[model samples]
Target: MEVSIIIVSYNCKSFVFECIDSIKKLTELITYEVIVVDNNSSDGIEDDVVIRYPDILFFKNDYNGGFGYANNIGLAHAKGKYVFFLNPDTLLLNNVCQTLYDYLELNNNVAALGCRVYDENLNNQMSYGKFPSVIQYLLEVFPVKWVSDNYKNKISSEGYLTEDLDLDVEFISGADLFVRKSVLDHIGGFDENFFLFFEEVDLCMRIKNAGYQIRITSQAKLIHLMGQTMQVSFQKFKWFEESRYVFLRKYYSKKFIVFSKSIFIFRYLFLWLKYLDKEWHKRAVFIYKLK
Candidate 1:
């Protein structure tokens, strides 16, 4: 096969259906198979999906094993030269799979390629960026635009909306990542250590360490209906914070981790005061005292 498209599905039934339909309809001239790993979604959408898209390979985990692990499951079953880890909330604007495949065929040095990602409303999303550090994470939390502006100047814009075909980036979101299967096999796939966030960053880090560049291309495009399956909730926030800690510990120093936690606590405390959601307040407090 030319490409194996793997989607780690959750409870987004209609979104996944639309995503698969777009793939089937838009993708031509490339041989690809769709693998859907249902991470214990309780909505019974898996049954409907299986009945609707009989060509798709469907598997269900006994329990929710988180994103990275579920993707690892799909990777184990993949049988293509290239593997595309796509989110079920995405829609192909064109023949993105073939475009990415052609990019890899021509480039030869890039280990992974991500496409320009937009929201359902067509607003460009920040889908590629520098590898996260304490400073980068803190800048994201606080609204200091000047500091962020300087950072962007140094590292270049994380969000690529230009007409340039190739944009090199430190990491790309797993939401629409296309990777060479050989490179993935060499690095042993995504680090399953991350439960929700930073898994893609970790994978990109490994790919870079193996002397390969990760890039973004404007030639291919996709609409990511961000947060379709998982809405913003206190639990989701906790998972993000926990995964951030995991990433910091894995890649940075203890001093940096402590500094990040301190800034995160202060920022979230201020946000809690401003928003005044009791549930969010309690979760923010829990995160503050997480260590």
Candidate 2:
């Protein structure tokens, strides 16, 4: 197989169908397989998907093992030279699989490649970024508009959100990552400790350390119905924060983690007091519990 497209689905049944349909409609130049690993979703996706698309390989887990763990399961069964880790909430806008596959075939030094991503409205979304740092996190949570805008502009200038040309990058969003299976095997797949966010960032960091390039190309494109797969709630926020800390712990020193946590606690506490918002207060308390 030229590519093994692995999608990890939770409760997003309809989106998964749309995503697979787009892949089937658009991908033609290369041989590929679709592997869907259901993360114990309550929705009856297994029956419907199997009946609708009998050629798809499907597996069901007893419980939701988070994003990385579920994708790791799909990765183990992958039989392609390249593996495409795609989100269920995404739809291809072109022959993205063929474009990325051809790019990798021509550039053997690239460990992973991602394409331009757009929202449902077709506005470009940030699909790649530098490795997370304390300063970047602080800028993200800063309250002042001018400061935040300046930081965003800086990121854009640094090519984190560029869409006009191909560039080497530090991390690619997990929403549409295309990587070689051999590189993944050498790196031991993804770190299962990450339940959701930062898993791909961690993988990219390791890949770069192994002297392979991580890149983004404008040739391929897709639309991501952002945040549709998982509902927004305080519990979801908690999972994000938990994964953030896990990532910090893995890539940073204990002292650095402590300092980062302090900054988080202080920032959230200030926001809670300034806005008198319950959400801010909840986030502050959550960060305190992590200490």
Candidate 3:
């Protein structure tokens, strides 16, 4: 096979149908396989996708394994030269596969490629970003978002301010990361440590560490409904806080982890004081439990 399109799905039923329908057209250009790794979603989605596209490889998990684990499951079944890690909520554009595949064909050094990312309204998103640092995170969440966003986040801002509809990007959204199978074997797929957020950054960084180039193909396009489909059964703040700590310990140095924790402390403090809201206090206490 030339390509294996892997989509890790949770409970989003309609989103899966639309995504597969779009990708279905691309089979003519390149020999491809679509593997839908169902993460044991509460919704009866396995029967839904399989009934429509019976030819698709459906690997249904009995448990709600994290994103990385579910993706690894699909990767194991992949029989393609290139593997596409696509979000379930996005729609592929015409020639999206061919565009990314042809680009990787010429540039053997490219470890991964991503399409130009746009939201549901077709607005350009900040598809590329510097790996999250304390300073960057500060600028993003601070009271002075207007100034920090425009001035400090230049590349991030520039990525959104593209003159051309589609252009090369530094870091593409993991929602649609297209990677070569060889590079995947070398890096051993996404750091299964990351359950959700920053998994792509960690993956791209590892590939760069192994001396490979990652690309954001200008021609490929996809409509991303950003965070609409991602969800957890528990309290949003609680679950995110749990995974945040997990991510920090796995990716950051001990000192960085300490620094990050302090920042989180101060952040919640600032929010609590500023809001003077009881909800803020509860969230602060929740984060403390994380430590």
Best by lDDT: 2
Order of candidate numbers by TM-score, starting with the best: 2, 1, 3
- Report the lDDT tens digits of candidate 3 across residue range 137-181: 666556474564556755342245344443444455778899999
Evaluated at residue 58, the lDDT of candidate 2 is 97
For residue 105, what is the lDDT in candidate 1?
97
Output the TM-score of candidate 1.
0.92
- lDDT (Cα) of model 2: 0.88
Ranking by lDDT: 2, 1, 3
Model 2 lDDT tens row, 6-39: 9999989999999999999999989999999999
Q: Please name the candidate that would achieve the greatest TM-score relative to the true structure.
A: 2
Note the Cα lDDT for every prediction shown.
0.84, 0.88, 0.77
Superpose all Cα atoms of candidate 2 onto the true structure and report the RMSD in Å to 1 decimal: 2.0
Whole-model lDDT, model 1: 0.84
Residue 81 in candidate 1, Cα distance off native in Å: 0.4
Question: Which candidate, 2 or 3, would have the higher TM-score against the true structure?
Answer: 2
- Candidate 3: Cα lDDT at 12: 87
